[model samples]
Target: MGSAWTQSFREELSVGKVKFSLSQPELLLQPQWSISPLAWLLYRLFMLLYTFIWCLYSALLFSSPKWLLFLSHIVYCSMAMYYLLALCNLVWAAIQVRNFYRNAAANQNEGSRVRGGSVGPFPLPPLLSAALRLQWCLHNLVSSFSVTVTLLYWMLVYPIEKHPLSTFNINMHVGNSVQALLDLVLSSTPIHLAHYVHLFLAACLYILFLLLYWLSGGTSLSRKPYIYKVLDFGRWPLVAAFSVIGFICIGLPLGHFLLLVPLKV
Candidate 1:
């Protein structure tokens, strides 16, 4: 019976014929405080605007004429992409909430709860719903990345005390890291182990990009093919292996901790 049900579900999903329904509005998954659809839409838009501004500011700081310069480094690319995905997810969520309410209003008998698989918010089609669920997961990983970057640069790579003359750099570093960490703390999204794949793939892609840049003869101000000294290709196999392991150690624990955050009822 389980196998038959699973097969039917898969077939329904393949044809986009599946519909999901939930009995209660409060049962919906949300990160942080739930607000009106308009408020949610505005919140996402505000974040999108901030992300755009930050990218421009970062570009100016680098003062590089080539657009590829930003793409070459994982920091800007990954972080920016994260914000973009968040913005998209917010839009989808807003739509879902709007649809939910509209359906509820139409069906005066249903109270505040969602019903039927017809066209309500709650149980979205499996694929799109799954994608929506990923938003917070990616957010957590990106937040982890932000924290990791700050710690790695400030504590392990170069302490602010050593670079006292570069106070502006310190401000940027602290601002970015603090904001990311705060966002994670404020969110109400639940973490899932399956979503760890997204984090892993993100890291792998960045490493691949760096290697490709090196192979293509990209160089920094110091004429090294790699942007960070820790990634210096000259050190080869050992450096590469250690860097990967080190990131996993930092990321996995951080992700697990986010999952462990106590949820407010």
Candidate 2:
């Protein structure tokens, strides 16, 4: 019966694909919060605004050569991107809260008194409350720290060069008498190091995120399901994706100018 029920629920979720959890905490809050559609829509609206701003920043840099070298402009754009990500997460958090409210309403309608108006049934499981609080703290701290550091790094490292791509000495093996290829990484770079740090922190955030989702659902971490195990392993692909993009975002523009550029492969 649970299999049939889970299957039906999964099918409905798949049809929309836009809403609900593929894994943990997202589903946790929905059943618990009873979030209203209006509340959810409001959060989505924030995301829309957030995306528009990102596009605006990109266009500004691509079109206006004047802003490219200005440290202040670069800082502003970086900060804007950070804020956008933060806004998205804030919306996610709201969705979770709403789900809590929805679930509370459901539980109350059944006369269970489970969570009066989203407080989560009295005497609320003390451990559950503690766990949820911990999860929230971890997620927010990671989010804020990552965004803050990223903005600071870009601001401090804005390039002075007009067209930075001219400097890298390129080597190619078209006629291969020798098969060896030279892979060079620049030795002195704060920007490259800062991005590495960001990658590490982001990984921490993803793991913390999964833990939080489990806590929100009142599920014990000890009993992590096969699905979550799959999510945990997903970190590798995420890291790979981020690595390429990070190099492009941080290293590519600078690498073009730097005397000694690193080979990402």
Best by lDDT: 1
User: What's the CA RMSD for each of the models?
Assistant: 8.7, 22.7
- Candidate 2 runs further than 4 Å off: 1-74, 113-118, 121-265
lDDT of 1 at 39: 69
Worst 10 residues of 2 by lDDT: 169-178
Worst 10 residues of 1 by lDDT: 18-27
Pick by TM-score: which candidate is best?
A: 1
Error of 1 at 91 (Å): 4.1
Candidate 2 lDDT over 182-238, as tens digits, reads: 101111111222233333454455445544554465222244331122233234556
Q: What's each prediction's TM-score? A: 0.64, 0.25
Cα-based lDDT for every prediction: 0.56, 0.36
- For model 1, what is the C-alpha lDDT against the true structure? 0.56
Instruction: Report model 1's TM-score to 2 decimal places.
Output: 0.64
